[model samples]
Target chain A: MVRRSREPVLWAMFSGGGMIAALLLPATVAVLWIAAPLGWVEAPSYEGLRLLFLHPIGRLSLFAVATLSFFHWAHRFRYTVYDGLQLYHLSQLIAILTYSIAVALTVIAGFVLVTTG
Target chain B: MAKALNAGYKRHYPKWHRERVPIFWWLRSASYVKFMFRELTSLFVAYAAGLLLVQAWVLGQGAAAHARLLNWLSHPAVVTWHVILLATLLFHTVTWLNLTPQALVLRLGRWRVPKTVVWAGHYAAWLVLSLVIVCLFVGVA
Candidate 1:
């Protein structure tokens, strides 16, 4: 019998998160930070943007992006410290700490999204 | 009756590089450091997402809260941070898109898609997304 490791599952999440981040983050940053602040575009009113977020789809989308991005960070940082810093001996501890923070932040994101009405 | 061929065979010891990799190995090579910087951008990506969450929280609190949050975000330090993050995020996006073909191999029947084609597809998708976002933000769509 062959045994499998859980690394693949984490890698899948990381890859998925990468796709989402690549597809979404640039446009988001452009709109929120660049276009709006620089006045290159007619930025939405604060009330309008907030109303959009209060909608179910907007909240869900934000939560998904946040959750995936955090997992992406967790996976990347896990390798960064483990391999980049040559801390392979502390792999288990590092993974736990990194993943724990990601999960905690994800929960905080969820809390902020759902309760922000 | 087999010949004694084994009698003349010699055993050699396995050789190793022996030299340990230095702690700052990435600094020695531009390519290595570039790769490291690409990997490092994930931190800022996470930061951007977390900041968005905070904005959502503040927006939920009400107008004054959101106003204060926006004001804070507009500070010089915050603007500088955003600029840095935007650059990293752009790098992340470009590299991720460039590497997409390697990760995702699309097949049609017995034929495999060419990497350049796949790369072009990713760029096209990115262009469409950015345009749509621009339209939405500018009230063109």
Candidate 2:
């Protein structure tokens, strides 16, 4: 809260985050490339370990692009639940819901790459 | 009484938007702008939900299907739109990431939460998430 009241910035962030969320459907197509499917473009990968952090520069770049973008969304969504639902009394609950879902989503991505990878 | 006052504040501000380019005019009235920004930031939730869904679906699909998905994703027109969309979305994320703290705790009686920490924590999380994504994808691929 800015000494007086600062809700506009928050609202802007909310709208911006919503706009960004619109990109996911198309971005999902990139999953094909990352997965190395037969006809896919191979734009990015989320495989695992050796290549994950230690691999060549190319791999690092791909993960960086995908992950950074992902977290940004994570941060944005956490607040959405709180203010959007007017769960005014459930701030912590909303926080958990927001961040946990992000964690779960990212974890699921990792799991898929690990098992199928 | 405080709640009533606050409600009046919202009614006169962004919560009850009266026009189309509220954002454009928002700059004209700093107070209104701030009010609107707070509401707009919620878009991130939508962005995250979309990304997560993509992750789940992509992971479930096999190589062949994944490949087809990529071919479509890479189309020149598609790529252009994707880049434009990503840029705008990131704008949404970065600006809002800076506001998460206050948003999390809009008000706790008279004790309010600081937004700086909220934004910083998000940046930190981005770094960690980035690393984790790198580890998983590079290794698997």
Best candidate (score: DockQ): 1
Summarize candidate 1's per-residue lDDT along B1-141 as a digit string, tens digits: 123666545476467675666778788889989888988889988988998888788878888988787677667787777778888999999999999889889999989999999999999998898887666556631
**Number of backbone collisions per candidate:** 0, 50
Q: Which stretches of candidate 2 lie above 4 Å from their native place?
A: A1-117, B1-55, B58-61, B104-118
The superposed Cα distance between candidate 2 and the true structure at residue B35, in angstroms, equals 8.1
Residue A100 lDDT, candidate 2, scale 0-100: 69
Q: What are the per-residue Cα lDDT tens digits for candidate 1 across A1-117?
A: 888988898898788778888988888887777667656667667777776666798899889889999999999989988778877789999999988999999899888887888
Candidate 1 chain B, which ten residues in sequence have the lowest lDDT sum?
A: B1-10
**Residue-level lDDT tens digits of model 2 in B1-141:** 767767645434545543433225446777756555654543433444444445435544655665565576567775665555445445554655665665566557896656776566667765566555444444454
Q: For each candidate, give the TM-score of chain B.
A: 0.82, 0.51
Interface RMSD of each: 2.0, 8.7
Q: Which candidate is the best by lDDT?
A: 1
- How well does candidate 1 score on lDDT at residue B90? 92
DockQ of each candidate relative to the true complex: 0.52, 0.12
